[model samples]
Target: MVSLIRAIRDHTDEISCCAFSQSALVTGSADKTLRVYSTADFKEFPFSPLTGHGYGVHRCCFSSCGSYLLSCSTDGSIIVWSSETGELLSAVEHPGRSPLRVCALAPDSCLLLAGACDGTVALWDFPSKTLRRCAAASEASIVACSFSPCSQVFVTGCTHGDLKLWDDHISLLLAQKDAHDLGVTCCSFAPHFKIEDSCVELRLASCGQDSLLKIWIVSQREGTAWTMMLLHILTGQTAPVLSCAFSADGELVVSGSVDKSVTVYDANLGTLLHILKQHDRYVTAVALSPAFGLMATGSMDRSVNVWKIGDGYEETEAESQQAPCQGRKLPGHSRLLLADWTEEDVQSWLCEEGLDELVMIFKTNNIDGSEVNHMSKETVAELGIESVGLRGRLLRKIEALKAEQSGSEAPDEFLCPITRELMKDPVIAADGYSYERESIESWIRGKNKTSPMTNLPLRTTLLTPNRSLKMAITRWKSSQ
Candidate 1:
């Protein structure tokens, strides 16, 4: 992807908006200042700070034609400004909470939408600069709001998992089915679709601490009401979903997460397409370039990453040269009964099975002589095994037989303690440790093996790849 890490003037506070236009990039900051940087040279333009908002500016957006700019602030004022000059055209005030969460300028009209923490969406006419309309939700802090392309309709999600839709005349309740167990953090409409004559198919995407990305299709009915249907539910991250945006084409939706990855999903299939994994902190915001097919992501890591997505997909060094089967495998267990066996395909398995964890043990020939000697000595020391983990004369005899099979470099050694083999395929184990089959066998083969008979509890694996091993361990500990 085209990298655009231009070093512009840095803000001491959080940057709430990076409004990009053909001529300039306007950024609103909590530092109570708006900086206009030239898009060509990444140089800051000299302008006086617009000083109306009593608190920090929270959101800023430019009109589609790039002729006007709109800013919402904690100062309870929504200010309209001219892009050419730094002149403040007008400031509209409301009696709600401070620091609006989102400010949206209509795509094809001279209308502006601002959502505040008081569950209110206030609409204003930019040309007349007057409060044209207002709508109140069910008494929950509004977290996000957006206007449709034609500026005929707008949507807002609140702190109470409620989704409210509004037009110029009346407030319409769209879908408020507990959209998130937690408060809704962000909401946006598809960027590609047009709001035209017949019927406009609007896709509403919402994310929150509930760790789910819900896609809904809201169709404007013949009358004043609209119907909403749940299109898809995406569950892949454990951390809170921070922000989401539709690609210009509307075929793809990119979501940022506290899980520290920007996940791109096919808006059609709702399947994950790619994971951008360079961020080292919680990703709070994301924007897709309209002209360059580039992605800009901002995070708590205090750095922004600009990546090219399509043909420019790049792989990390480890991923590029990784062997197809670099990990090791374990032999099937003989002493223990079938830990897991598949009678039917995975999907046919009952949902009640959920995911289970299993530990397995196997025997294998040692690769190097020194390595075998070290392992054997350690096993004997830790387990008090005459050979590996057995004691007494009969066990000694069994050890001698095992030794006979083992060459100078451990030829055929029975994996000790008869731990349940970490099966790679989903199977029911003698112990109830069940989960999606992973390379636990591979991990065991290369490490100091632990005793299968030990009272150590089975660890539960997280269902998402975005979760770290630390999270897995913590979850496991908490469950115990």
Candidate 2:
């Protein structure tokens, strides 16, 4: 479940863009200023409301390392600021003096790319703040731009429904005409890549006025321009998707739409997971945090909502190095591998699950832990249990047991109260208790509104990874 943690109404005008770094978040608005906030508490930066742009700021971006923030405005200039102090660092006036629509920073922090309303694409040496080249590459307004992970290639989308690929030298490589039906609004490259044989495989997401969200597979060989193939077309938004971005791990994707809604999708499955309807007007921009379970969505309603995302994929270090037959003990449980459990242990588990009558059936089949762990409904019925409800209850209890077996003989301080297991990727929640990442996420997903330890009301569901505690646990395990 996704919960809104905070709604910021700091912008006096409609928000134009919002971006998140590891420690800070920045939002640009038509009010001619940008606001910065500390990620720790979502507090405004001391030097926020960065004032210098003479006109409305249309787009903003943070460098890969979060040291510098860049914003382009109708004033025909790109202004750079120190993210830490909000001091004006440098500025670049557009060569054509055209209003910039979108901008992107290369992942390697070597270059900057900005697209203009006059169809010009400008490349600059970001470190030195020097203009490299400015070329008129399209007949229509350039609305979207993104750079490949390798920084050797980039893509730009225009109002004519064209998506063009380019090399670092401002040379056009490939052009896909009418990629979107109406116009392109936004595009983003997934931050991670894989090496397959001689080519690198990457994923990119783009949304447009066509009311469609697209996932594309981009492939590039050594010293070659990237080639793309359409992979998935996500269609959960009824209106045009104005903004889209992939999570840092590339496992999830999120988008905001003109429908006044935000949608999160499982990128790998192409499945829609949640629809958030908090904005009264069009949601214009969306950004996802790289480490923390945080998301920022900016809307035309003049607000930015910070949300807490539920994560279920975090794995603990202990689990990865677990032995098949590792020995440990829980307060009221045994930490034995399912494959090693005897028929007697299985019977005891059935009794604990309130399935005393099924003990005879399981005993007849010699169903040990291994067999029960792999049982399907069909297999359960084959055991002469004709009750459909009974089969479901048995299966659900097995899943609960799987969620419980954290590790054996772990310290009490390292165990999550809800799961009664050693912490795996521990995170601290609003109640100031550290828990296994997936355990608390599952707790919040089940609609529990109170702390598991204190039973008091939970002020927020935001979970920050407990790095210090995690390091201590790792060191203790190493000495064991």
Candidate 3:
């Protein structure tokens, strides 16, 4: 059973979109503003209520690494913001003169696709900061869009009950299928999973006003062609299904509907697992935290509910025991823990004195201590540690304790600002910060040449490898 942990009554109007990241929860609203809440305290950011959209904000998304946020509004603009500071970074003008309804970021974070009210899909290249292509995806307005885990393919849902597949780079149509009886409301791509033979299979989930959820198996055929086959059609919602999401491990699917209920399903077999009737009004958005087994739902009742799906919601032991080992594997992120530490150790560490809030933030955002150590100073402050001196002291103490218990700590300067991880390959950005080579390069190429840490305009795109930092990290790892 999933129990509601808390209800956040922050929005004054209907919540239209909600996105989760390692640090925060962001929601777009018919109130025409975006509200940001700390994952730890569920307290609104000091800089909450980001405003600029002249109309309702329709969608909100976080970049793959959680350093940036993208939001589309009915005013025909897509605004990018620094996730850490809640400051507006840039606004991309909509290609068509119609309200934008849906948008998606590629897994690589290098490409962006936006579906507008005029039935046009616009493709943008982050590196060049230019609109590369725009094409009509349907005769009717688009409702939902998602990119596959591999970032090679994307799917778009239209108001005409059509689902279209497109190639990632060229925005070329690969296939189209009439998917729903009424307008399709939401679509999501399952996380990548491997088969017994080490082959990968791509799956897509979609929901619609017809009150049904459909799963499709996507595969590439020989000679540059693709195929989609219906795998399952789930039914139970008494009203229109508004949103759907696949668990990070691709083992489950969750959907929210106008019936004021949230439903969880076994992704592989389409078996009904649980129905949570907690909302009083239509549920507009639903999100799952793969790392924490937490789910969030936003509703037209002007409330957001957070639920904990811990051991109480797990499948029966007999069921799991009957499954193959390969079939039972979880996502890598969910399994990450400190070396030589048990689950109890993690829980104890999280409950340590004065660290309760930090722990909640970590769990809600699906982050851990290791990742927190790499966060930029600005991000650390935004997490509720306001004082710079206090923040520095806390970080140092945490590092010392980790070192005393685990092993040598990576030098703070050796961490990447964008990924909040120890730099595997350090590179110096124009802003003078040392970041992981690939992370910084991706940010530069995918986020319109802006610095992730400083949020300043980059003087140049060229990045110089930081050999000294790389050597230092290598030495630290070797000593450990």
Candidate 4:
């Protein structure tokens, strides 16, 4: 279970976007000011409320090392800020100076990308602040973008509902059309990849105006060609899904919706874990800290809420055995994801929903949760539902079910091997497992000097920052 830690109501206008560095959080607003906060205490970072954009700010991001923070604005510029000092480092303008809608930094800290409302993409050399390529990527507005784990290719999603892959040079590699109906609001790539015999596979999470969150399997084979396959389609929010992100390890996914809700899910099983409702208006942005177990959600209500999602690890026996729905259990098939229910489950659901009269008809037609999700007015008529009012009522219920997640692991890397708690600051000792920095430091100070996991003499009393694990903890702390 997750709990809200705080709700920060500082921005005076609607929050357009928010992002997390390993140690800090930054939010951009329609008020044209960007505020920064220390992850250590959630207090305003020194020199915060950066006033650089001439117009509304849309999006922001931090480099992998948290050295630089970037923000794009309707002012048609992407400004770079020194992460440590909040000083303006550089300003790069989008081609044609059209209002910039989105921006992303490659994980390598080598490249910067900015998407303009004019349907063009500007790729810049981050280290030098020089424009590398400017090209047209879509006919509709480019609103979402992310670099692949390899940093050789990037993906961009537009308001036209198309997702495209481009090489670092901004050359088109592949394109998937209508990946989302209506339009795409956000897309994110997991931080790491898996190696198979000949292909490197990665996971991607994308949400859109269709009010659905989708997972994609993107792989590269032969080191030349690429393929993208749909992995799962998650419907967990009632309104347009405005933002989404993959946990650093890519095990869990989170999304924010215009329905003023935040939803978390098991990335692998696509099971609903929890639905949190606290924002008074649309949740416009969501971010998770890498190793800090922090999640921040920004909303149109001018508030940003922080949460503590357990480090992404598999659940314990007790947690896994807990009832799916707390307080009261679902009567039957309602406990399953709508697409996984069987015929018997559907029959039980109908009976529990006070539609027992339709059980025989549904059973006769082999209708289940999957079938229910595909129901339209025509499909209902085909089911021999004669009453218009009853048919309409069933459709409404089906729609409502789509937005609910029932409940759902943490990866071990985020836990301190000594304290067995989610590490606030993770560090890697010679033992090969990450542990809380304070716990390890204390162990080194003791006489034993033994590895916590191995009970062997420590190779050395030194610990290095587990930067990757920290990124994992930050990716899914969600709000409301």
Q: What pairs collide in candidate 3?
A: 40-361
Can you write out model 1's per-residue Cα lDDT over 375-408, one digit (the tens) per residue? 4444535433334333243234334434543423
Could you give the candidate ranking by lDDT, starting with the highest? Answer: 2, 4, 3, 1
Which stretches in model 2 have alpha-carbon errors above 4 Å?
A: 222-225, 312-480
Which segments of candidate 3 are over 4 A away from where they belong? 170-173, 193-200, 222-224, 311-480
Ranking according to TM-score, highest score first: 4, 2, 3, 1
Best by lDDT: 2
lDDT of 3 by residue, 1-480 (tens): 565554666765678889888768888887778988766656789888898886678899888898888898766688888888889988887665456888888889888889976678888886565898888888777779998988877899887788888886545555555698688999999978434353446899999989999998877644445777899999968889999999877888999999988999999999999888756589999987656666788887767777666553344332232222211111111213345344333333444323444545555566554554456667777777666776786566556555554545455476665444578888888988888888666555544454554334689988899898888888888887
- Residue 104 of model 1, lDDT score: 82
* RMSD (Å) per prediction: 20.7, 20.5, 19.5, 23.4
lDDT of 4 at 365: 93
Q: Estimate each model's TM-score.
A: 0.60, 0.65, 0.64, 0.65
User: Residue 197 of candidate 2: its Cα lDDT?
Assistant: 77
Return the top candidate by TM-score: 4
Clashing pairs in 2: none
Lowest summed-lDDT stretch of 10 residues in model 4? 321-330
Q: RMSD in Å for candidate 2, one decimal?
A: 20.5
Q: What is the lDDT of residue 96 in candidate 3?
A: 51
